[model samples]
Target chain A: MNSEQQNATLRKMAQLMRDGLKTQTEPFPETEKEFAAILEELRRLDPGDLEGKMVISGFVDHPYGPDRQRCMECMYYLVHRQWCDLPELAVPVEADWWCRLWRI
Target chain B: MANLLWLQGGACSGNTMSFLNAEEPSACDLVTDFGINVLWHPSLGLELGENLQKMLLALTSGQMPLDIFVFEGTVVNAPNGTGEWNRFAGRPMRDWVTDLCKVANFVVAVGDCATWGGIPATAPNPTESEGLQFLKRDHGGYLGKDFKSKAGLPVINIPGCPAHPDWITQIVVAVATGRGGELSLDEFQRPKTFFTSFTQTGCTRNMHFAYKVSATEFGQRKGCLFYDLGCRGPMTHSPCNRILWNRQSSKTRAGMPCMGCTEPEFPFFDLAPGTVFKTQTVMGVPKDMPTGVDKTGYIKLTAAAKAASPRWAEEDIFVV
Candidate 1:
């Protein structure tokens, strides 16, 4: 996709989350087993179902905790393209965005 | 002539194969150039039946001077300590190890098996396997903690699943060429020359590691494997990247994670499900931090690095 299209998609996702989008953010995966289970849940979703991934992975537009953990710090984040490179997620993301899939 | 004797116990002979494949100071070079006399080897020894028995007996009885005793694999003491399962030359191989270790001037333990009991001694250890001088992190093994050869040194451990080929031959040559005393060993009795550096030293991915770029999947040549992939390169000691396997590349070089085979507690986490290739994490942070990194420091570093990460880090730099 073109840069403008990609930016629009990211903006749309961010707006959706900010507008009281209730996601599966309650159960934060504390362990790898728990984390893997969450990923497995994500895998069952259709790749084209971007909304399903965001909801399942606990997408928040901004940093969530005191540490200010965000997509920029996450291992799967791509700074140049402003994207989430995780094959399971594959969403356009803002650097300041937060998700449960975040890892350093 | 330095008479070198090689033996095996509860092993897969992986080290022997690696030894035979040595390039710089190859196995044949040991005989031709280094003047190492091969008294016997499990694979190379021509003796069979009565002749093999005679050779072993001769060495035990002090008729044949054993300059170096190279032991590969773990010493099996099984079936209620009888050691009857692995017999060599009409006696338990463990029996020969005891005798040979006593007589040999320098004793060298050739792989993870002989150094620290390896996978055979992992858990439930049905074979009752133990290294010549160590069992995992413990000092006392088949050979007692204080046990040393006639050269007044502990068993020289060159550990790996199969130790690097040059490490085996080079140590053997060092002992054979009257430089045995010059060889310095670490706490684990591995030669300080090879075992001193971490596998991360001199790695091609060091740039990625410094910039905190993570390689999420295997065979992606751009990012560091330590972040998400269970790579022990940063903490485990070995000169894999420096020396270069096959004189070209290492496990991490080709995008494979270092298994930390050189360390005594290898096959870490006991080959448990989801342990081998995936980095074990707690709350999305690595469970085992790099050697000395604390959680607070790691968090701070991550925050700074991620924020400061260059745009280039996100792109495929290794352009074809």
Candidate 2:
């Protein structure tokens, strides 16, 4: 995305987190099948439902869990772009931010 | 001239097809240039019926000196180990293999089936298929571990789904040209020259791998297959990238994940659904790390590599 558009999307995501969007965060997908099911759910949502994508993916503005899991260490995180590269969950994210979809 | 006899057991003749396609020292070159006398091959042999039986008997009886005995596919031991499932001429094929190896100067196993039991030896292996000297990772297959040819060498294994055409012909040529003693074999009995190197050694997507840019999906030219797709190139040993398949591209270069076909545990996960193409991960981390790398090291490396990844790495790096 262009810098300005990316910034706008990032602000939108940050606002959702600040508003305490009650996302499905407890049940972390431990297997690919479970992981795929989450992706399938995201795929089913309307592409314009950016907020729904954030909620379903369990996005948090700060690192989550005892391990401090964050997007910075995830394989799909594009450090330079400050974006999540997962095709299903493509979104602007922060370095220290996290989600249940976080993977190394 | 080295008298070479080629035989098949419980095989699909895939190795035979590969041998015919050899380019470096073509199959025809073995006869014309390398002085390898074609005694009898499943495809090239002229003998049929009784003549073939008589010729096999001659070799076993010390009448005809068996120089190079090449075996393809697994030795089937079925129906209570009677070997009745796959019979050659009057007796079982395993009997012929046993008899032939004893008399032959050199015994060479071609293909994963012959070297390490291939797909036939996968879980619930009803066919009772066994490699010549090793079955899966177990030592002592159809031939015991200590068994050797007249040349006092263990069975030389050239393993692959169907061994690379060049590896088969080159090894045959080497043995035929009297370099048999000089050829070194690894713990798996494969020639060290070819099986020692990893398939990822010269992969085109190595830059993507370093940057931790995952392909995520198939046929994407921008990312490494190892992260998302079950590309075993980093762990499996083979010169697939160096000696490119068809002389131009490899599985990784063509955007297909390396299936780890060269390894003994081929058709990994026993062709289980979802395990074939998708990377097996535990808690978002790869189950199979690169050779010599541990989980802690991988986590640290991924963090560093992804942090340092260039912007171009996230996009298509391949230019037309």
Candidate lDDT (C-alpha), each: 0.90, 0.91
TM-score of each: 0.97, 0.96
The TM-score of predicted model 2 comes to: 0.96
Report interface Cα RMSD per prediction. Answer: 1.2, 1.3
Q: Write the per-residue lDDT of candidate 2 for residues B48-159, one digit (tens) a residue.
A: 9999999999999999999999999999999689899999999999999999999999999999999989999898989899999999889999999999999989999999
lDDT of 1 by residue, B97-118 (tens): 9999989999999899999999
Over A34-56, each residue of candidate 2 has an lDDT whose tens digit, in order, gives 78889899999998789899889
Give the TM-score (vs. native) of candidate 1.
Answer: 0.97
TM-score, A chain, model 1: 0.91
Residue B224 error for model 2, in Å? Answer: 0.7
DockQ, candidate 1, vs. native dimer:
0.74
Worst 10 residues of 1 chain B by lDDT: B311-320
Report RMSD (Å) for each prediction in the order shown: 1.4, 1.6
